[model samples]
Target: MENSIILNPEKITADLYPKKFGKAGKIWTVILIAVCAIGLFAYIRQLNKGLVVTNMRDYVSWGIYISNFVFFVAISLVGSLITAIFRLANVEWSTPLTRIAEIIAVSAIVFASIIIIVDMGRPERFMNLFIYGRLQSPIIWDVVVISTYFFISLLLLYLPLMPDLKILNQDPSKNSRFLNHLYRIGGSFWKGTKEQLKINNKAVTTLCIIIIPVAFCIHTVTSWLFATTYRPGWDSTNFGAYFVSGAFLVGAGGVITAMYVFRKAYHLDKYITDLHFEKMGRIVVMLALLYLYFNVNEYLVPAFKMKKPEEEHLKELFTGSFAPMFWFAILVGMIIPIFILIFKRGRRPLPMFIAGVMIMVGAWFKRYLIVTPTLLHPFLPMHDVPESYKHYFPSWEEWAIAAGSLAGALLIMTFFVRIYPIIPIHETINEKNEMAEKK
Candidate 1:
């Protein structure tokens, strides 16, 4: 039965195949473009009026924008984790998921680059980082590493896409004249010759090897931005591990969420089955536990020590202004989902969707904790700034921009699914052939 399912490609593939966006898809695209335009306008306003428009003063300088940047980078790691790791490990079942993971990685990393620039106090001065970039500063490392990560991720996405684009180019019905021409130009050279295939495969493998270190560098540098500081919560000896684990957890949660939505919308249950969700639920649960362990180390030890600098920050999260958010993040993000996923029923699609949503929402707050709380507990007391600067809440403009970036990601994923085979048709067929030969 499994062989039959694999050998005879389901008609579902034809039905679910990447199609040009219909009216619904086009409308969705337009809405995202409009939202993004408004955000660009607001950003221009902020740039003209100075950072004063942001309500972020020196103490709370890193606000929603920076947190949003971290979220994008964290989620981008899904590409390296799921797609490259599984492919190189020769995990056959993962073929259906590689495109999804790769697209998410590419989209998130693209925006990770953008959002960090948005967070810059002097974006125009960004060239200064290049002109006068110092190896000594974590910021320079972040810029260098993130750019490398983005390119490798883009290559990882594009390399696999070559074969698929060749397939897509054959379908005169599914693309526009422009897209048809684009594919012709982009992939006309790819005839899928055995030599070409061998070379392409080797290149992907090499990139898979290289991206691991590049991915680690990007996130570790993000953590260093905090750990290098003298601030209490950010000063933790365990910051790097804590950041990496939580990053993966959130990233997996994102992939799971997107998987469920795309599976249903595209009617891909024949490919992305309950089995994938069940397996993903188990992975997410493990990551959550790992992150929870780090969370204990991150906060519990600090809470236990009650260090003079840590006191105010800990109080703020435990019983002060941030208490409700803190507990909600823990309960909704980690604890409840962990328990739910352990149950057989909970690993099913609907419950897993609920868990995915919880994890993603919690991850946002987790980034907030990583960002805002540290600023609130700056080495010096909050003074000489407007009272508004003392508190951190994303202005409507901020929310609009963040939401637009997310919408942009969805649009990219949506259009990608429309144009390319979301599940690798060629790879799936090859694997099935190999299995049949073995039999």
Candidate 2:
């Protein structure tokens, strides 16, 4: 008899199907929901009392909220990095992680939009962007590109889930009636016929191509929001590339972090193996190195000149009030992770998870460093403003709102896992078939 295949459809289905959340999962979901509730409450308070509730003043008008927005936009780049870029490159090993990246992208972008509105203070004025917005504004560009990227990321996510949805719909007995209904609604027309698969594949390929440029545009436009200004720190020709590189680095870190968590929580070791972590480890190291190179260019050239305006901004980050955070974000975000992931043993799942967490935390503070310090050190000296306006710190409401937005994103990923196969079931089966045939 011919040698048996490594992965049969039945086993794949059973292993990869979405399962009901157990006690720990339930507790986690509840916590995320609670955090979201707190954030919503904070937002309500901000609306009622106005922007004065936050620490934002004339000197530091852009506070942690903008930092959070930048962080979300950075993290959202992972979808294009893993899903579109990897798919177009024919990177087969990445199949298991694509959905994870896409969902992260979708959720991060969703919150990016929400947080920008939060930053606007007067939420009702948002509609003015559509009605009276000028094309000359970088803010308008950001609005356009981010919205476009969200839909493309959503489609990329939903299209791949169609085949898996059809599989779930076939056996309603295994899942709740509500879930069964959702599966049916999502995949009712997906007959999996040859023509349908061909069209689906083509459409996906087209989207994969389209999303790359749009993803770049989204973050590039965002960098322009700062760089276009003649402010000491923001005025740099390198800002666009600097922002894009950091975005990719954080995005990869996020996917790696998610990969480890899902593999452990869902018992997906068969699909998300050690090899996947190893490959992702390599990607993260390269990204970290690339980001470090840009970091050097971003600061070194400015430091060499040390213009009067930039002198204060750079000093504050180098050895002043922001020094600790500045170094922390640099070391933890890029340097230490590079050290950890450079060695072969460090690339293991547990170590990779540690490094991923470090990257994420470091990246968040890095954004804080990027936005807050520069605003405080504008070209013009602070006039006779209140002494409190010279320094900045987030208020309770700002913290709650920021934390809640993060929890909301996590809750989205959590609920998505509960409803759909976190790993692509049908795709994994197809890949296994191809491997077995080659043997």
Candidate 3:
């Protein structure tokens, strides 16, 4: 007779429970808070001085803030990709990564909203959009879809989190009294009965179904914000799919980066094994290739035509002022990552982490290229505008605020990990039990 081994539920709980942050975590948190503080200070200055403090001008109306907003929107797609899409597809290897992706999605979307407000000269007028907005506008579409996506993403995050909350509440000894109290408040009604699990599973499945289109809509509408415009580079039918593919790529890179960080920080080697990174590396390669194809479609076809309106803009990106950053984004974001992740040995944790960072950094520059260069090369051409209007560089204040927004997003994820099990404990136990029985 063969002996079957079963994972100890208590041991699993002990290994997976959220633990107090050590010295390094405390230092990291403090640094993020400090960056957020600096960003807030910069925002206040911008508020007091108005748009004059920044380098945005008539020709280059949109700047790094818009780029950051696009980046946030792009990265937020990961929640839908990892959590909802993976769940619906029944991909078991992704189980440990769902919450990490969810928190990143939630945090990214929250900052996306914030950074857009930071872009507006009159932040107070944001409510007027709701009071006096028109449905025909792509802006209105973006606002509606983003708000809808946020809520659905939140529910997807919370619904799956309840079971873990119940486990945390039941095991008060592992948590601080305050954390235990918060857990009970959140999960007190969750008795883990069959009916409750059934309803929860159903709700999660329903959200998975709903979030897919909503996720596509959110980024698609955002791409429309540019595509609907008559600007040189903005006029393209390909923007929707272009933006969506890039979003998935960046979002996946973000998840890969976080997977490595959390696995190291929390000593989750057993849970977040190299196999997960290997699988994600494959996904990233595919996404990067898809995005690269879109990049070709976006630029190559236009460059081939050299449309008078688009010629200067394309030149600026290809062999002109923006050439360095443009090539950096392409090579680092797509080509190099493709090469690195294409090989099996490169799928290991450290190499994958390096590739993930490359993808993210390159993606940010790619967004910048998408926004700024075209604005500088509008259809009307520069005439009688200030030399300052001919050029655009983010002011110190803009850089500070952008850095702060990124830091703030990181802070949200950091705090979430501190309070909740970054990996779902109850789900892991159930998976282990099933695996044991199968074995």
Candidate 4:
């Protein structure tokens, strides 16, 4: 009842103000920062020594960095799902999750950009993509869409926060000098008048509509990055749906993970309730099945045909050296989680969290499998290259950069939660009020 719109405004405000992190939060922040620093050191070493520090060669031109990039891009789709998709569908239960999803999308996209840059050993040559880039290239399309996606995501996150910002601005006690200053800067023009509210809602609706296709474009074009290639595994028409479906699965899983963490860390159990987890669990299962369908289409058709090129590639994934990781990704990422979450009890917070972690870790390895094995099965054999070129493994520097990018994404999410209310306070209040009225 404290969160109901009928409740005293002051109490609702008290529930939503950003809280100072406790000892555990502080320690977690430190760990993330330290990991980022280590990654930075490794990047500096790479800059000094060149890509020689990594195990990459002609055969395995793409490695974990590309996989990490794919992972980031995949998880970033949550913005479209929870924010745009749910909002447009008028699913009020998702009100509390939009901000968190937007933040995750923004953070993941940020690191997606960074990891791509990291993949380009000579960062200075990045401008070549602009000056010398062809319009037909999927890479260029990716650049255009991802940049658009990031800005749109930022706007989506900011627009909903305007009312809350006005709240924080009015009460000096609610936030410190810097935060209050941010509140003023961001929401000073938002008067919450009838005209302003109408315009804001219209703008949000328009953005939600626009972002959905752009979201699909980013991952679809990303899949084209491989599919357009002549390699064995990459040469599939199903790649677009495969990548997009997997993106939704991982993005949903990431949201579930964030929901659990924020619910516990910020004592948001009142806002992000068990029912929320139940709904998200059902969503995860649906997405997992969708992804599984794509996985079957991606693999089974090729297996049935068994062309010379597809033969070795499918063998590698089915029963060869990559079998363990391949099976692990499929089983943990989709199958096991599906089975667990099929039960009502599995939709609980803890089980959902476990399933989310499994999906995420498995998805990461899935991306790795997507990029690496195909390169290993190129159209031609590696004749003159060293034995190292024949086998691909990420070097310490590569792992450091990849891990650092992941840590940095989480760090961004952590800092955002520290600064802003993870749940949309105004929206939650309105939702509770509506339910109360209905009752």
Candidate 5:
């Protein structure tokens, strides 16, 4: 198997090296930078005015920003899933993808932090979250878990890179000063000594054990931000599991999408192979079905009762203004992907990419559903506000900032792949050697 992978020091060096932008890559970088800049401009305007610039009011206090934050936290869980869960379970095929998952985790979690800060009405008084932070508040719980998750994810991404960084630092001819300096700073002390390996092994094991629960906590606490409220769609016993399962699904979907893009652009076909995508398709299908099952429970139980609050919410979802987005999310995000994945052809890269897009896009709407509809069905009638305030649509500033955050995450991932190996070089080689031994 090692022989079959056709390792070429030069090909690996050329293909995996931090590339100067190709035309498309350059164009993509420009577009993302432009969007982020616009988002920054809009956000500055928002800061100058207030959250008053946007459409949200007291009734819908938590709108698209909260939903988008949840999306980031949920998807960040894929890092733990691929890097920790698969590694602990000794799943060999997942080796190629560990860094992809971990990088996504790190980047997503990083911006999860940023976007939450952006969402704050009082962005300037931000230390209030800490200065007057309440331990009992789910928001505080979120702060705790997100911080812990971030460190664990950072270590998860970094520990695995030592060997590769050491390799990079040794090349005297590589003229990129920043990266060469970064490589030295990252791995100058990493001699890959037996003791260093042992310490690294132990640290990774500790993080692996620790991150699983922290991962659950991050998403669950995120759900709790809703469940703790006495709102219609959010007030349920099932919210935690439903969110966690869906988080795993979307996180898996995100990683799948990122994996395809990275594999294509970096020409890492030999490293991040087709088998990984097939297996990830199976994983996404399982998670999607699980989440859909929970969605039935989440909706049907209250739906069966036709309770006043839930009745209004469910009706809005089924037949009112929100209906199209709701059904589109359910069918496209969950049902169709599950059905398609059952066929082998559908799990191939192209169809899998299509399915990945559906899962991600649908997951966005799903997060919106989790947030807005419930707010709309507030226990108190939404009165004493303007007509437009009664029905929420994002303002242009909101859209720019939201779109910017998404662009920012993608930009981070793109820059990361350019700087570091998107696929783990040491791990992929080790897996190949192990397979050769077996053969």
Candidate 6:
């Protein structure tokens, strides 16, 4: 008996077309807009009052904004994981996931850029980076790679949508006036000719090749921003690999979360099936284990050596004030997820979603642990500063803005789905036909 899954082309098209937002989606959108408004107000206040409105001081220069930036960068790696790596490896099951991952990547990177600007109190001075930017600086490297990655990710997203755009363009009943305009503007020329198809395929493949190294560079440069510093926790050669590994883990977790949400919201059981969750669950576990290995390497050697310079910093993470966050990140982010997904039932959609949330929340706090603790234990003793400088916590403004930025990112993704098909209708149909033929 051939146990192959088959999909009908017309049914697939009907099921996957972009639909107007339902009640739940509309409520979600309104909430996101409100949160973004709050964030905007907070930012205006920040501009008026300066960074003094926040708890960040000399000892803890980078706070929630930087942590948020790092989290965005880490989660954005899912674009490469699903679209580039899986596509290049010829994985068929990921077709439903590529667009999801790409949108997540695009949204995350967009906010990553915004968060960086948020960290810079004087936004106008951002131009100075171009005027006085030095090749020698890691910050410049980060800027270059992030810009390059964003464009490449955008193109990766747009290229795959061209064929689908043609589908939407031809079907007058499927598109609204606004969406029809968008489809025409974006893909009026995509006639699905043999030459056009060949060119598009090559373009996507070439981009897949190019983006892998650029994605690596963006995160590696980010890691360099810390590893190059003289702080005890930050000064290690293992930082790059550790950051990359953790990024992959968080990105995978993000994908799992999206998979469950889209599956439920769109009633996409036939498309994003339980098998998809199972396979993604396995990938998450593998990434969790890999990141766990790096965590051991990152912490164990330093703890074992216990050098005088690192003792206080290591102690803070292991048994001191930051110990709670550190262990939560390790256990909830990596360990518990692994244990959950290791079992057959845990790979189900509901459990996978819960595990994904844990990983993301844990990773966010992990970033805080990465940036704050190291700065707090500076090599030089603190003197002549306000006592508030010794302790660090984000003020109400910081919390509001961070929440708003996050809400805004989700809103962008939500709007994108409302406007465009979350899955690649053309690609999914093609894959279905190919699988049927093979069977």
Residue 198, candidate 6: C-alpha displacement in angstroms:
0.2
- Descending-TM-score candidate ranking: 2, 6, 3, 4, 5, 1
* RMSD in Å for all candidates: 1.9, 1.9, 2.0, 1.6, 1.6, 1.3
lDDT of 4 at 66: 95
As for candidate 6, its clashing pairs are none
TM-score of each: 0.95, 0.98, 0.98, 0.97, 0.97, 0.98
Which parts of model 3 are misplaced by more than 4 Å?
1-6
Residues forming the 10-long window of minimal summed lDDT in candidate 4: 1-10
lDDT of 3 by residue, 383-415 (tens): 787787899999999999999999999999999
Off-target runs (Cα >4 Å) in candidate 4 are 1-8
TM-score of 4: 0.97
In candidate 5, which residue ranges exceed 4 Å CA deviation? 1-4, 8-15
Kindly indicate the candidate among 1 and 2 with the higher TM-score: 2
| Superposition TM-score, candidate 6 onto the true structure | 0.98
Evaluate residue 2 in candidate 2 and report its C-alpha lDDT on the 0 to 100 scale.
17
For candidate 2, what is the total of clashing residue pairs?
A: 0
What is the clash tally of candidate 6? 0
lDDT of 5 by residue, 1-439 (tens): 3237766555655556666668989899999999999999999999999999888887778788888899999889998899889989988788778888898898889888988988899888888988999999999999989999999999888998887786676784773888878788888898878999899888988888889999999999999988998888888988899999998999899888887887787677776677777889899889998999999999888888988767888999989999999999999999999988878888888788889899999999999988998888887886577766678888899899998998999899888877887766666556556666787
Residue 315 in model 6: shift from native, Å? 1.1
lDDT for each residue of candidate 2 in 71-130, tens digit (9 for 90 to 100): 999999999999999999999999999999999999999999999999987899999998
TM-score of the candidate numbered 5?
Answer: 0.97
Find the 10 residues in a row with the least total lDDT in model 3. 1-10
Whole-model lDDT values for every prediction? 0.83, 0.93, 0.93, 0.91, 0.85, 0.92
Best-to-worst lDDT order: 2, 3, 6, 4, 5, 1
Evaluated at residue 337, the lDDT of candidate 5 is 94
* Clash pairs, model 2 backbone: none
Least lDDT summed over 10 consecutive residues: which range in candidate 6?
1-10
